[model samples]
Target: METIKISVIIPSYKPQNYLWECLESIQVQTMPQEEFEVILILNGCREPYSKAIESFISKHPAGNLTMLQTDIPGVSNARNMGIDNARGEFLTFIDDDDYISPTYLQELYNIAKDGITPVSNVIAFNHVTGQYETNYLTECYKHLYNKDKITIMQARSFMSVPVAKILSTNAIGIRRFDPEFKVGEDGLFMFQISNRIKILKAASPSCVYYRRNRDGSAINSLRPRGQRLKNNFKLMTNYTKYYLQDIRHYNIFFYISRLVAEMISMTFAVRGKIQQ
Candidate 1:
């Protein structure tokens, strides 16, 4: 049997209509089907959702696609399950609501190596407006437009999300999501993974991950300020602990300070909005 070069992990909970589009995008990737495998984990909700996904997989026929359903509700847990079952040498994550360009996988895979990871441009697509716009992540990509390779500090924004990057399995070995966090988990996970990666290669700009910006989405949904602050505290505490151990490998201090600054700025912004 041939080795699986990439494992695409997608975790869904009460997935919306967009899940089909996400699956469709992967099915049409330029990468050969045999070189990659798709692991779909339906968490929290089962039965109808699982049956629907299973039926779609059967009909669409993307080679090496596996669907797993778990009682766990969080995306982090579902992704952890996918990681445990993955056989590919490299792994990439895609949210169930978002899709990627046809060349996303192939472009990232071309530049990926043991100590080097590849980053792709992220495009924010407004589901309601049917418009595509540049987001903070896209700006981060532009910051490195002139460079071929960079460090975690250079592509700091990449640390915040797992999407739009191809990571070596060895780099991610034994590290899993901190299930306790509903927010900032991606950043912390990537921060941990960065310890093993020596450099990050910028993939072609054409390789894009279409991030859907819609109401009630994780990014758009607003939680209670107390909950947000609590999660933010936990995130900072975790980042601090890891930085103390791998201070030379990653500029985690930057993340810690920036997160604190963002929180302060956000509080002011909300206050200003209310005053107006």
Candidate 2:
């Protein structure tokens, strides 16, 4: 068997046919199917989801796909399973609901094989409006635009998403998501990876990250008043601890600012609940 050049991990729950469409995008990639593998992680689903994924795989044998089912919940655990099972030289993640262009895998693979990480243009597509957009985050990090090599400092300071980057398997070897964090887990994982490797941004937009305009479908979905407070506290504590060590600046003021910001956000959140 030919060595797998790339491994794309998609962790999904009951995403309906959205997962199937996401798989279709990969099926049409410009790269050779044998060179890359797709690992679909079905997290905490019963008969219908299992049946659906089995049906998807049987229809698309050219996908070179491997589907794994885990009874354990959470995207974190699902992703961890992907990391453990992957057999490719380079790795990247795509949300089950999102789809990429035909050139997505090939373009990023070309950059990554030469020992440079490749970050792509993330087009946030409104599933409802059928609108695609590259927002201000890319503009704000203009230094990374059209570049093939990026320093840790440049990567650290800029806001980035895992979907935007294809990383070396060696670079991400054994790095697992913190099961403790339901939110901000992906962010922290990216932050940790960028700190350890050189990342490059792909020249053009190649992925359509579908965002539906719906409540309860996002990471920040509103929770019950008491549960919300606990989750918020966990989020704050993790961020504070991470930033305290992450603040590379010598100035004490910047460190203090992060703490203050977290506190202020928490205060207003609780205040809003009280007022309600």
Candidate 3:
């Protein structure tokens, strides 16, 4: 059997036509097919969606790709299953609507190390405008342009999201996304796995993750201010628990201050929401 260098996990729920573009991008990676595996999990919805996905797979043949289905709805649950079945030494995540540049996987694989996480630049592709723009996270990652690596404390801001990054399987171990959190699960999952990551490295500028910025997408969806605050509180509790354990090398003072700021901001946000 060929060695799988990386595994790309895509958790798709009630997907749209954009899924085909995402899959096609992966199908044409710069890396050879045998070097990586793509695990696409169709979660929550079934029947027509499953049949549609099956048809897509049949039409576009990829020997390295594997499609799995589950009645579970949460993206975190689907990702957990992907992690459980991942056969690669390194792992990266891609949303069903997002796609990566041709050299994305190869670049990530080249820079990935047991104690390091390689991050890619995220480009927001406007669906309607047909234009690409620099995303907020990509702007935050500018600090990495000249440096070789930085600690989790330095990369904390942008590290909140799991996209545009590749981590080693050994680094991830058994840490999984918290299914309880629908809002801040990505940040919490990154926090859980941060214990093993000593440094963050930036991949080649060419290694880009094209994030589709469109209406009704999961990232753009909003919840009530009260619900968001509740989710924020739950995330704070989880973050505090992991930080207190001191297994990871992060600045406690910095983390505490961030939480304090978030509390104030959330309070004001709720007030504004109520006023409106």
Candidate 4:
């Protein structure tokens, strides 16, 4: 009956091979089992995945683990469902394919409890390559070393993409991932929330994000050059229109430059010039 401090929302889609490790990491958290709730959103997966998650939850009844199913098919919809059903003060998003350290929740909880607003840590490991990458915190510090006034937009612009970050679910208001975008949903979601919330960087490498390298993975399978370019363009336009509305002086130019950079990257990705 006690209130939970963190709600870990994992949006799973056909993650049978990887879900166990992800769940195991959460189960072994250094934080008290009572302090957090793990909510798995099984978005439009077949019975096998649902049964697997259900069985795991049944065995670990001591922890507050809940499995919810939705016929709605995208990762965005699944994440949005998790947000609606969450009962914790702070929310942390973990991909079904990634694993977190035992102290992940406790560290995030400590910062959030101290009123850090929106805080995110460094995500180590690229899910696609299965190799560790430099922590985002280190990257951010390098850009604005020993400087304050680290605005959300600046952090977001520098981070490039946002995943594996802990955020105050309520302070940013009840915002959900834009259901339309499939590829850049995380980036757009971060951009939208950055406008309203003050985000703090937790300088730690705590989360292991596994970037899937297989051909069948969502990122790899999305297809033709033209379609991919169109989607990326749409993502940039929608994100910019919603978040960066000030439109003054050189800031506008910088915003357009970032979007252009993203477009160029997408062009290379689609043309097989660079591997995403």
Clashes counted in candidate 2 amount to 0
lDDT of each: 0.83, 0.68, 0.82, 0.68
lDDT of 1 by residue, 159-275 (tens): 778888988888899999989987778878987877787678787789999999877777665666656656666776787788778788766555565467446745754564311
lDDT of 2 at 220: 43
Tell me the spans in candidate 3 whose CA falls farther than 4 Å from its real position: 1-3, 113-115, 247-250, 257-261, 273-276
Better of 1 and 2 by TM-score: 1
State the weakest 10-residue window (summed lDDT) of model 1: 267-276
- Screening candidate 3 with a backbone cut-off below 3 angstroms (N, C-alpha, C), the clashing residue pairs are none
Q: All candidates' TM-scores?
A: 0.91, 0.81, 0.91, 0.80
Per-residue lDDT of candidate 2, residues 1-276 (tens digit):
345888899998877767777889889888999888999898887678888788888988785898899888889898889888888888878888778778888887877767777666555556566675555445534557666666554554332356656778777766678888765566556555543564555546543333333334555465555655565577557655755664563223433443454466567667764211
lDDT for residue 170 in candidate 4, whole number 0-100: 65
Clash pairs, candidate 1, are none
Instruction: Give the alpha carbon lDDT tens digit for every residue of 202-270 in model 3.
Output: 776788898888877776676788777877787788888888887346566556754774577577657
TM-score of 2: 0.81
Write down the lDDT that model 2 would get.
Answer: 0.68
lDDT of 4 by residue, 1-276 (tens): 345788889888888677898899889989998888988999876688888887888888865898889888999898888888888888888878767777777875775676554334444565567676675544664564334345555565433454545677665476678898777777667656654455454434453333333456675554567767777789778857864564432234445655776688697866676434
Error of 2 at 271 (Å): 4.2
